[model samples]
Target: MFSKSKINDPVTGKETDAPRPSAPQAPASSGAPAPKGSDFKASAPKVKPPASTLSADLHVTGNMKTTGDIQVEGTVEGDIRAHLLTIGESATIKGEVIADDVVINGRIVGRVRGLKVRLTSTARVEGDIIHKTIAIESGAHFEGSVQRQDDPLNPGAKNPPSPKANPGS
Candidate 1:
Protein backbone atom coordinates (compact mmCIF):
# COMPACT_ATOMS: atom_id res chain seq x y z
CA MET A 1 0.00 0.00 0.00
CA PHE A 2 1.30 3.48 -0.94
CA SER A 3 0.63 6.30 1.51
CA LYS A 4 1.68 9.96 1.55
CA SER A 5 3.58 11.16 4.62
CA LYS A 6 4.14 14.74 5.69
CA ILE A 7 7.83 15.70 5.99
CA ASN A 8 9.56 18.78 7.34
CA ASP A 9 12.16 20.68 5.29
CA PRO A 10 15.34 21.17 7.29
CA VAL A 11 16.40 24.40 5.53
CA THR A 12 13.02 26.18 5.44
CA GLY A 13 11.53 24.67 8.67
CA LYS A 14 8.21 24.06 6.85
CA GLU A 15 6.02 20.99 6.76
CA THR A 16 4.82 19.68 3.40
CA ASP A 17 1.65 17.52 3.17
CA ALA A 18 2.17 16.68 -0.52
CA PRO A 19 3.01 13.15 -1.67
CA ARG A 20 6.72 12.39 -2.17
CA PRO A 21 7.78 12.09 -5.80
CA SER A 22 9.63 8.96 -7.00
CA ALA A 23 12.14 11.00 -9.00
CA PRO A 24 14.48 13.77 -7.79
CA GLN A 25 13.37 17.32 -8.60
CA ALA A 26 15.69 20.03 -10.01
CA PRO A 27 16.28 23.20 -8.05
CA ALA A 28 13.70 25.92 -8.80
CA SER A 29 16.18 28.79 -8.50
CA SER A 30 19.93 29.34 -7.94
CA GLY A 31 19.28 30.85 -4.46
CA ALA A 32 17.11 27.94 -3.29
CA PRO A 33 18.43 26.01 -0.31
CA ALA A 34 19.54 22.42 -0.85
CA PRO A 35 17.47 19.46 0.32
CA LYS A 36 18.05 17.67 3.60
CA GLY A 37 21.31 15.63 3.67
CA SER A 38 22.29 17.11 0.29
CA ASP A 39 25.31 18.85 1.76
CA PHE A 40 26.79 15.58 3.05
CA LYS A 41 26.19 13.80 -0.22
CA ALA A 42 27.75 16.61 -2.30
CA SER A 43 30.93 16.89 -0.20
CA ALA A 44 34.09 15.17 -1.37
CA PRO A 45 35.27 11.99 0.33
CA LYS A 46 38.37 12.12 2.56
CA VAL A 47 41.26 9.87 1.66
CA LYS A 48 44.64 9.31 3.32
CA PRO A 49 47.92 8.97 1.47
CA PRO A 50 49.45 5.50 1.37
CA ALA A 51 52.85 4.67 2.88
CA SER A 52 55.54 2.58 1.14
CA THR A 53 56.27 -0.76 2.74
CA LEU A 54 58.72 -3.59 2.09
CA SER A 55 57.42 -6.96 3.20
CA ALA A 56 59.39 -9.46 5.25
CA ASP A 57 59.92 -11.90 2.35
CA LEU A 58 61.13 -9.24 -0.10
CA HIS A 59 64.63 -7.93 -0.87
CA VAL A 60 65.70 -4.71 -2.57
CA THR A 61 69.03 -4.09 -4.30
CA GLY A 62 68.57 -0.56 -5.60
CA ASN A 63 68.42 2.89 -4.05
CA MET A 64 65.07 4.15 -2.75
CA LYS A 65 64.08 7.80 -2.62
CA THR A 66 60.74 9.09 -1.40
CA THR A 67 59.43 12.28 0.06
CA GLY A 68 56.90 10.30 2.12
CA ASP A 69 57.27 7.72 4.86
CA ILE A 70 58.67 4.20 4.44
CA GLN A 71 58.44 1.03 6.49
CA VAL A 72 60.94 -1.75 5.89
CA GLU A 73 60.31 -5.28 7.13
CA GLY A 74 62.66 -6.95 4.64
CA THR A 75 66.29 -6.76 3.49
CA VAL A 76 67.79 -3.82 1.58
CA GLU A 77 71.23 -3.83 0.00
CA GLY A 78 71.16 -0.19 -1.17
CA ASP A 79 70.76 3.28 0.23
CA ILE A 80 67.41 4.68 1.35
CA ARG A 81 66.29 8.28 1.59
CA ALA A 82 62.92 9.35 2.95
CA HIS A 83 61.15 11.75 5.24
CA LEU A 84 60.52 9.10 7.86
CA LEU A 85 62.01 5.59 7.92
CA THR A 86 60.97 2.70 10.15
CA ILE A 87 62.90 -0.56 10.28
CA GLY A 88 61.07 -3.57 11.66
CA GLU A 89 62.60 -6.07 14.07
CA SER A 90 63.04 -8.71 11.39
CA ALA A 91 64.50 -6.36 8.80
CA THR A 92 68.13 -6.03 7.68
CA ILE A 93 69.82 -3.13 5.86
CA LYS A 94 73.27 -3.22 4.30
CA GLY A 95 73.59 0.36 3.04
CA GLU A 96 73.34 3.98 4.05
CA VAL A 97 70.11 5.44 5.41
CA ILE A 98 69.27 9.12 5.18
CA ALA A 99 66.07 10.55 6.57
CA ASP A 100 64.64 13.19 8.84
CA ASP A 101 63.53 10.60 11.36
CA VAL A 102 64.92 7.07 11.55
CA VAL A 103 63.69 4.35 13.91
CA ILE A 104 65.68 1.15 13.92
CA ASN A 105 64.56 -2.08 15.55
CA GLY A 106 66.53 -4.37 13.27
CA ARG A 107 70.10 -4.91 11.99
CA ILE A 108 72.08 -2.34 9.99
CA VAL A 109 75.51 -2.94 8.48
CA GLY A 110 76.11 0.53 7.01
CA ARG A 111 76.19 4.20 7.93
CA VAL A 112 73.08 6.00 9.15
CA ARG A 113 72.55 9.75 8.87
CA GLY A 114 69.48 11.49 10.17
CA LEU A 115 68.29 14.47 12.14
CA LYS A 116 66.72 12.20 14.72
CA VAL A 117 67.77 8.55 15.14
CA ARG A 118 66.47 5.99 17.60
CA LEU A 119 67.73 2.46 18.14
CA THR A 120 65.31 0.15 19.87
CA SER A 121 66.17 -2.62 22.26
CA THR A 122 66.45 -5.28 19.57
CA ALA A 123 68.56 -3.20 17.20
CA ARG A 124 72.00 -4.32 16.05
CA VAL A 125 74.15 -1.79 14.21
CA GLU A 126 77.68 -2.33 12.89
CA GLY A 127 78.29 1.04 11.23
CA ASP A 128 78.87 4.65 12.20
CA ILE A 129 75.96 6.91 13.00
CA ILE A 130 75.89 10.63 12.18
CA HIS A 131 72.95 12.44 13.69
CA LYS A 132 71.97 15.68 15.33
CA THR A 133 70.14 13.71 18.03
CA ILE A 134 70.24 9.98 18.79
CA ALA A 135 68.89 7.57 21.38
CA ILE A 136 69.99 3.98 22.06
CA GLU A 137 67.94 1.68 24.23
CA SER A 138 69.54 -0.46 26.95
CA GLY A 139 69.47 -3.74 25.03
CA ALA A 140 70.66 -2.31 21.70
CA HIS A 141 74.01 -3.51 20.28
CA PHE A 142 76.29 -1.07 18.46
CA GLU A 143 79.82 -1.78 17.16
CA GLY A 144 80.63 1.53 15.44
CA SER A 145 81.43 5.15 16.20
CA VAL A 146 78.70 7.68 16.91
CA GLN A 147 79.18 11.32 15.95
CA ARG A 148 77.02 14.34 16.67
CA GLN A 149 76.80 16.99 14.00
CA ASP A 150 74.97 20.28 13.73
CA ASP A 151 73.65 19.31 10.30
CA PRO A 152 73.65 15.58 9.93
CA LEU A 153 71.50 15.65 6.78
CA ASN A 154 74.06 17.70 4.84
CA PRO A 155 76.99 15.51 3.80
CA GLY A 156 78.96 18.34 2.22
CA ALA A 157 79.04 20.56 5.29
CA LYS A 158 82.48 20.99 6.92
CA ASN A 159 83.00 20.61 10.67
CA PRO A 160 84.34 23.56 12.69
CA PRO A 161 87.97 23.38 13.80
CA SER A 162 88.69 22.48 17.41
CA PRO A 163 90.24 25.04 19.75
CA LYS A 164 94.06 25.02 19.86
CA ALA A 165 95.79 24.11 23.16
CA ASN A 166 97.91 26.83 24.85
CA PRO A 167 101.55 25.92 25.48
CA GLY A 168 101.86 27.93 28.75
CA SER A 169 98.86 26.36 30.48
Candidate 2:
Protein backbone atom coordinates (compact mmCIF):
# COMPACT_ATOMS: atom_id res chain seq x y z
CA MET A 1 0.00 0.00 0.00
CA PHE A 2 2.91 2.36 0.73
CA SER A 3 5.04 1.36 -2.28
CA LYS A 4 4.57 4.47 -4.40
CA SER A 5 5.08 8.04 -3.25
CA LYS A 6 5.85 11.22 -5.19
CA ILE A 7 8.71 13.31 -3.88
CA ASN A 8 8.76 16.94 -5.01
CA ASP A 9 12.16 18.23 -6.03
CA PRO A 10 12.72 21.48 -4.20
CA VAL A 11 15.29 22.78 -6.70
CA THR A 12 13.48 21.91 -9.97
CA GLY A 13 9.94 21.69 -8.61
CA LYS A 14 9.56 18.29 -10.37
CA GLU A 15 8.09 15.04 -9.16
CA THR A 16 10.56 12.24 -8.28
CA ASP A 17 10.30 8.60 -7.26
CA ALA A 18 10.50 8.24 -3.48
CA PRO A 19 11.35 4.52 -3.16
CA ARG A 20 14.56 3.61 -4.93
CA PRO A 21 15.66 -0.01 -5.40
CA SER A 22 18.89 -1.02 -3.71
CA ALA A 23 21.87 -2.08 -5.82
CA PRO A 24 22.61 -5.78 -6.03
CA GLN A 25 25.46 -6.89 -3.76
CA ALA A 26 27.98 -9.46 -4.87
CA PRO A 27 28.97 -12.25 -2.51
CA ALA A 28 31.88 -11.36 -0.30
CA SER A 29 33.78 -14.45 -1.31
CA SER A 30 33.80 -16.57 -4.45
CA GLY A 31 33.60 -19.98 -2.74
CA ALA A 32 31.70 -20.28 0.54
CA PRO A 33 28.80 -18.02 1.30
CA ALA A 34 29.47 -15.35 3.84
CA PRO A 35 27.15 -14.99 6.82
CA LYS A 36 24.55 -12.31 6.56
CA GLY A 37 25.62 -8.79 7.58
CA SER A 38 29.26 -9.70 7.54
CA ASP A 39 31.24 -6.45 7.28
CA PHE A 40 34.69 -7.90 6.90
CA LYS A 41 36.63 -6.29 4.05
CA ALA A 42 39.38 -8.39 2.60
CA SER A 43 40.91 -5.78 0.34
CA ALA A 44 41.08 -3.04 2.94
CA PRO A 45 44.06 -4.01 5.08
CA LYS A 46 43.90 -3.35 8.80
CA VAL A 47 46.47 -0.94 10.13
CA LYS A 48 48.16 -1.09 13.51
CA PRO A 49 46.67 1.47 15.83
CA PRO A 50 48.81 4.20 17.26
CA ALA A 51 50.05 3.75 20.80
CA SER A 52 48.09 5.30 23.64
CA THR A 53 50.28 7.94 25.19
CA LEU A 54 50.48 9.08 28.80
CA SER A 55 51.88 12.59 29.12
CA ALA A 56 54.94 13.32 31.22
CA ASP A 57 53.04 15.22 33.89
CA LEU A 58 50.37 12.58 34.39
CA HIS A 59 50.54 9.95 37.12
CA VAL A 60 48.46 6.77 37.20
CA THR A 61 47.88 4.73 40.36
CA GLY A 62 45.87 1.81 39.04
CA ASN A 63 46.42 -1.10 36.71
CA MET A 64 46.32 -0.61 32.96
CA LYS A 65 45.61 -3.26 30.38
CA THR A 66 44.87 -3.31 26.66
CA THR A 67 45.28 -5.40 23.56
CA GLY A 68 46.75 -2.40 21.75
CA ASP A 69 50.03 -0.59 22.14
CA ILE A 70 50.84 1.88 24.95
CA GLN A 71 53.57 4.51 25.32
CA VAL A 72 54.20 5.97 28.75
CA GLU A 73 55.98 9.24 29.38
CA GLY A 74 54.70 9.58 32.93
CA THR A 75 54.66 7.53 36.12
CA VAL A 76 52.63 4.39 36.73
CA GLU A 77 52.38 2.68 40.11
CA GLY A 78 50.51 -0.41 39.00
CA ASP A 79 51.03 -3.26 36.63
CA ILE A 80 50.56 -2.88 32.87
CA ARG A 81 49.67 -5.42 30.22
CA ALA A 82 49.55 -4.57 26.53
CA HIS A 83 50.44 -5.87 23.12
CA LEU A 84 53.32 -3.43 22.94
CA LEU A 85 54.54 -1.26 25.82
CA THR A 86 57.04 1.55 25.41
CA ILE A 87 58.48 3.47 28.33
CA GLY A 88 59.72 6.92 27.41
CA GLU A 89 62.97 8.41 28.66
CA SER A 90 61.26 10.33 31.44
CA ALA A 91 58.80 7.64 32.38
CA THR A 92 59.00 5.58 35.56
CA ILE A 93 57.04 2.41 36.32
CA LYS A 94 56.87 0.82 39.75
CA GLY A 95 55.01 -2.37 38.88
CA GLU A 96 55.34 -5.37 36.63
CA VAL A 97 55.05 -5.01 32.87
CA ILE A 98 53.76 -7.64 30.49
CA ALA A 99 53.49 -7.38 26.71
CA ASP A 100 54.43 -9.00 23.43
CA ASP A 101 57.04 -6.28 22.93
CA VAL A 102 58.50 -4.12 25.70
CA VAL A 103 60.85 -1.23 24.97
CA ILE A 104 62.25 0.63 27.94
CA ASN A 105 64.08 3.93 27.70
CA GLY A 106 63.27 4.94 31.27
CA ARG A 107 63.19 3.33 34.69
CA ILE A 108 61.29 0.28 35.90
CA VAL A 109 61.49 -1.29 39.34
CA GLY A 110 59.36 -4.40 38.92
CA ARG A 111 59.58 -7.56 36.89
CA VAL A 112 59.26 -7.33 33.11
CA ARG A 113 57.76 -10.08 31.01
CA GLY A 114 57.53 -10.06 27.23
CA LEU A 115 58.16 -11.98 24.07
CA LYS A 116 60.72 -9.36 23.08
CA VAL A 117 62.30 -6.84 25.46
CA ARG A 118 64.78 -4.12 24.70
CA LEU A 119 66.60 -1.70 26.99
CA THR A 120 67.99 1.44 25.45
CA SER A 121 71.18 3.10 26.57
CA THR A 122 69.38 5.34 29.02
CA ALA A 123 67.14 2.67 30.51
CA ARG A 124 67.40 1.73 34.18
CA VAL A 125 65.79 -1.51 35.37
CA GLU A 126 66.01 -3.10 38.79
CA GLY A 127 63.83 -6.19 38.43
CA ASP A 128 64.26 -9.51 36.67
CA ILE A 129 63.37 -9.83 33.00
CA ILE A 130 61.65 -12.83 31.42
CA HIS A 131 61.58 -12.75 27.63
CA LYS A 132 61.85 -14.94 24.59
CA THR A 133 64.40 -12.47 23.22
CA ILE A 134 66.11 -9.51 24.87
CA ALA A 135 68.54 -6.77 23.92
CA ILE A 136 70.38 -4.31 26.13
CA GLU A 137 72.23 -1.38 24.64
CA SER A 138 75.53 -0.13 25.96
CA GLY A 139 75.30 2.21 29.00
CA ALA A 140 71.94 0.74 30.00
CA HIS A 141 71.85 0.48 33.77
CA PHE A 142 70.23 -2.86 34.57
CA GLU A 143 70.68 -4.64 37.91
CA GLY A 144 68.24 -7.48 37.21
CA SER A 145 68.63 -11.10 36.17
CA VAL A 146 67.49 -12.13 32.71
CA GLN A 147 66.00 -15.44 31.63
CA ARG A 148 65.03 -16.59 28.14
CA GLN A 149 62.12 -18.87 27.24
CA ASP A 150 60.49 -20.08 24.06
CA ASP A 151 57.11 -18.78 25.19
CA PRO A 152 57.87 -16.03 27.62
CA LEU A 153 54.40 -14.50 27.41
CA ASN A 154 52.99 -17.59 29.11
CA PRO A 155 54.95 -18.24 32.26
CA GLY A 156 54.22 -21.85 33.22
CA ALA A 157 52.12 -23.46 30.52
CA LYS A 158 54.00 -26.32 28.90
CA ASN A 159 51.40 -27.54 26.44
CA PRO A 160 49.23 -25.00 24.68
CA PRO A 161 45.81 -24.80 26.24
CA SER A 162 43.34 -21.96 25.76
CA PRO A 163 45.18 -18.66 26.10
CA LYS A 164 44.61 -16.74 29.30
CA ALA A 165 43.01 -13.34 28.77
CA ASN A 166 44.46 -10.58 30.87
CA PRO A 167 41.82 -8.62 32.78
CA GLY A 168 42.29 -4.88 32.52
CA SER A 169 40.79 -1.52 31.66
Top candidate by TM-score: 2
Predictions in order: lDDT: 0.86, 0.86
* Candidate 2 lDDT, 93-129, residue by residue in tens: 9999999999999999999999999999999999999
lDDT of 2 at 69: 97
Question: Model 1, which residues run further than 4 Å from truth?
Answer: 1-48, 161-169
Candidate 2 wrong stretches, greater than 4 Å = 1-44, 157-169
Score residue 168 of candidate 2 by CA lDDT. 50
Q: Write the per-residue lDDT of candidate 1 for residues 17-59, one digit (tens) a residue.
A: 3434432232332236657766534334766467799999999
- The lDDT, on a scale of 0 to 1, for candidate 2 is 0.86
Instruction: Give the RMSD in angstroms, all C-alphas superposed, for model 2.
Output: 9.9
